[model samples]
Target: MESPLEPLLDGRTKGFPAAAGLLRLGQVGSMGWNVLAEDLPLPLAVLKETALRHNSAWMRAFQDLTGVALAPHGKTSMSPQLFRRQLDDGAWGITVATVQQLRVCRAYGVTRVLMANQLVGRQAITYVLDELARNPTFVFYALADSVAAVDALAAAAAVRRPGRSLDLLVECGVNGGRAGCRSLAAALAVARRIKAAEPYLRLAGVEGYEGSVPGPTPDQQERRIAEFVGFVGEVAECCADEGLFGADPVILSAGGSAYFDMVTSLPRQLGPRATQVVIRSGCYLTHDSDAYARAAVRMRERTPAIASLGEGLRDALEVWSYVQSTPEAGLAILTMGKRDVSHDLHLPYARVALRPGRDARPRQLPPDCEVTALNDQHAYLRTTEGADLAVGDMIGCAISHPCTTFDKWRFLPIVDDDYDVVDAVATYF
Candidate 1:
């Protein structure tokens, strides 16, 4: 069968240099184009190949140590190529936030999908049922935090009557979080409703997102996360005892990029119930320089196992842009801005600078230099006095949130340590 990714190999991809002229994505490696050498367009987003491999392996090792399965959230980098990498690296399944993302995974031949969010809406529900009926080998799971959601899904499943029941994980959420049931009692009620739906719907397990569980302090936050995980575990146990669980090994999933160690405690709480603890960490694949890096430090402090896993996750993604203008002292306008990188949690930071002909090699930008603000196509870079920055100097920036950044670009080149393009991945959104 022809690979689904073959279409993305076109030379017309956003970041591909026009001079390369209709080259295959795999052939980019042999073309000898280097980022620092100015072989491609500036304001380009690229992934460090070595760091990508390391992060994947590190997460795999973490899963092995914790005895849990990973269903890496696909919403972070809606790129099918990255999905292939995660699947090849031993991801149990690709977790998406929408039915459109599920379609992308299905188009690329992903056999298993976990829609981390609730599968609502008639169109979305019908699409899922169609897929389940078409592909016998396919496995899918979605979240449900309310009786209405369970009933909605059950209604769609009953109408289609696919070969098997639609699997659903009851979502247990925090008071002010995004989705899921706000209380344990609410979560159990939803799970029981799912069981009542019978042959149309199956209670797979309980799941939640701990990243939104707020804590006034770090200690309080950890305590709240523990409490939230415990709440989810309780829901699962109650459903199991009531014979509400439809799957043999009930799944207890929750874990964003941060606080996965605490989420791993689900298995311990289940206590003899056949369960599969799955962590849906999306950003761990291309861990950012800002938010997730700080989270990693806290994770190591709480879980000694991470520190012992050789070197930790490095920032694999970087956006390189030229210094469009150095109009005044201590100020440089970069070609990259909100359109190219991320600024949701923290603004992109200047990491390295390279002058095309004047510099011998790329040098680390001064610690005092920072991205003060961003415009649609320009960034306000505040440099320390005598920072040696000049017009035309390429500035490589490290983003804060990989999810937002990955969505901005349709394609990101995978580069080696020397900044040579090795491979490229295409994003759907």
Candidate 2:
């Protein structure tokens, strides 16, 4: 049977025979090809295949250099396809923020998971126990902050099969961040409680987040992060001294995208027999040319090891909005709004402008062309020199924060080197 695109190659459509033939041969789908090169109004988010592959390899190399395993947080893309790629690249496991995210990873056949956050509440504890019982080989780790949290897991684990312990990590918290044991005494107390509830829960090791530690300078940030990494090392030593891990390998997980170098230096404090040091940096998968690019630059100045990460991770994510109204002499209102690209971190980068079927070319707007504000369906762009911009012209905006940008879209397309769509990647979140 002939496919729908086969008709385009039968000399029916003029001037699109090559596209039609490629589509019929299953080299490219009709929808993807048409949307990418033809400038169709598809309302889609496109991921460049070459960039995606580059980012993956770059992360793996970073992990190799740092001596810390990369278990990229799965909450960013939430795409099973991306998760499968990370797993194939020898990722220890995937990290998620919540139990619902665990279900998402599970649906993708991901067995090993690190619930980076805590598993609080009765239902969440039950979910964790059920996940453990169902997948016997599945290793799950969650942050334990208090006695109540440890007791809840202990009670839940008791109801499950005997001899099975819920692998748990004590989260060390700074005064500002979300969940974690505040001090060494507090952390040791939490670990003691877990050990007291023994046979049901095992104190894996220590886990902490350095990303949330804010500072006025890079040195300050690094110092603060190193302090947490030091805390992780101290806990690792304490756990081993207390013989908490027993036969199983003790796990020490830390590092978010900003400052993994500090966490890489943690083994010195953890001593031998620490076994595993997992770094759960999520945004490394889709490194943004804006936020992370500057971050990488700053990190290079301080560390220099992270500067040689990789190439081809361009800001491929863009919001293709049409010029809806050319109100003033130099002002153009776009069809995109706050709902498109994220405005929390930084503003978007203007990539290029396009007209229907015309090759996309970089157009320099006035030095003052800035997106001042965005409504739900319109973007107010201010321009200098009163330059004229016609309505219906499409404006491509390069995004800053990929994490927030990804959550805004469910289905995103995958494009080739020449901005031609090869496939489409979709996210559950």
Candidate 3:
């Protein structure tokens, strides 16, 4: 099926200057705007059409092999078009961070949403309950790590009396983690509280994010992820035995982008609770070229089944910037910087380069080419010997974390393998 380009969200958009006009959604790229050909403005983010479809299919295959449903974390892209694609391809639901993001998914007609984060504040809580009351088909669930949070949700639900029960997953956390209960016992206690909340709140199941587990070495990291993921299942079993888990098809979700493979094998151990294990690894949609690439390698190493798929996730996302100046030998300043791409996990990788009116195919960057520094609007590209780089050359950078990189763009053009802009998607950050 042909992908539909979302209509121009608004004329006054940033990054892509040509978007400011009365343009047809499916025909914006009719003139064949090529990233390498310099058709769009500089510092533009683009997704490779082939790679995106391949990544989505790869994830679905993983789900099929494991018998686990997918509620891909929507916070990674926050594009309703992507969410729709994920669902249409067999995702269980969309996972979002805040109520505001949930609203965006709802606006796009998503019936089921998993609020991976705890719903805090009266306003956010009120909004969720009101929506559930208004929409009969809406299936929403959130995390509760502490009794205080469960109490807040229960009180808010009681006040709203949406005639609907709020589903909650008892979040188990690793020590030194950001959210969730640090121990299995603590998580179970919160589950009991959720059950006690009665009609206001229902103990849906157990959820945790294994990405926060601390491991000094890769081996240690795998061990820790396994341990935490195991605990989540054990807690689910305990909750079921204790009658705390009242929601059927109990949720046993615990898969971040890095260690999802470890989390996917949890259903067999979760006992016969009629549970559904959800892998919420959102970054798999736009696999990174650096950090997550390394993680995927690790996944293939520890699990031979994944490596058997030949090439796993490909680099689907890239940002284009021009070489503004060659300040010194082996050093070039690029027009793209932190404001355009992600530098939090690691600096963007110098993947490919295109010289306008010269290179037809994008050439891979030199082995020693690296982006060492990034200012607000400039990237310092440092290359070693045998590096042939010139001014006015377009540098295509592969990012590390799709989560942070996406917030920098309001709109991203979906491009084909030949760098032709075929469709576009709006970002709701």
* Displacement of the residue 312 alpha carbon in candidate 2, Å: 8.3
Model 1 spans with C-alpha error above 4 angstroms:
1-3, 8-12, 268-272
lDDT of model 3 at residue 290? 87
User: Candidate 1 residues 1-429, lDDT tens each?
Assistant: 335475434446657788877765556778888988888887899999999999999999998899999999999999888999999999999999999999999999999898999888889999899899999999999999889888888888888989789999999888877898987689889988998998888998889899999999999999999999988888888888788887478888899898888998886445566898999999998999889999999999999877778899999999999999989999999998889999889999898999898777789988999999999999999998757888899999998999999999887889998898888887887
lDDT of 2 by residue, 377-419 (tens): 6788776664446786667677778888788765565667666
Model 3's TM-score against the true structure: 0.94
lDDT of 3 by residue, 79-142 (tens): 8888988999989999999988998898888999999999999889999999999999999999
Candidate order, TM-score descending: 1, 3, 2
**Estimated TM-score per prediction?**
0.96, 0.88, 0.94
- Candidate 2 residue spans exceeding 4 A from truth: 1-32, 36-42, 268-272, 308-313, 360-368, 384-388
Q: Compared to the true structure, candidate 1 yields what TM-score?
A: 0.96
lDDT of 3 at 193: 94
Whose lDDT is greatest here? Answer: 1
lDDT of 3 at 170: 93
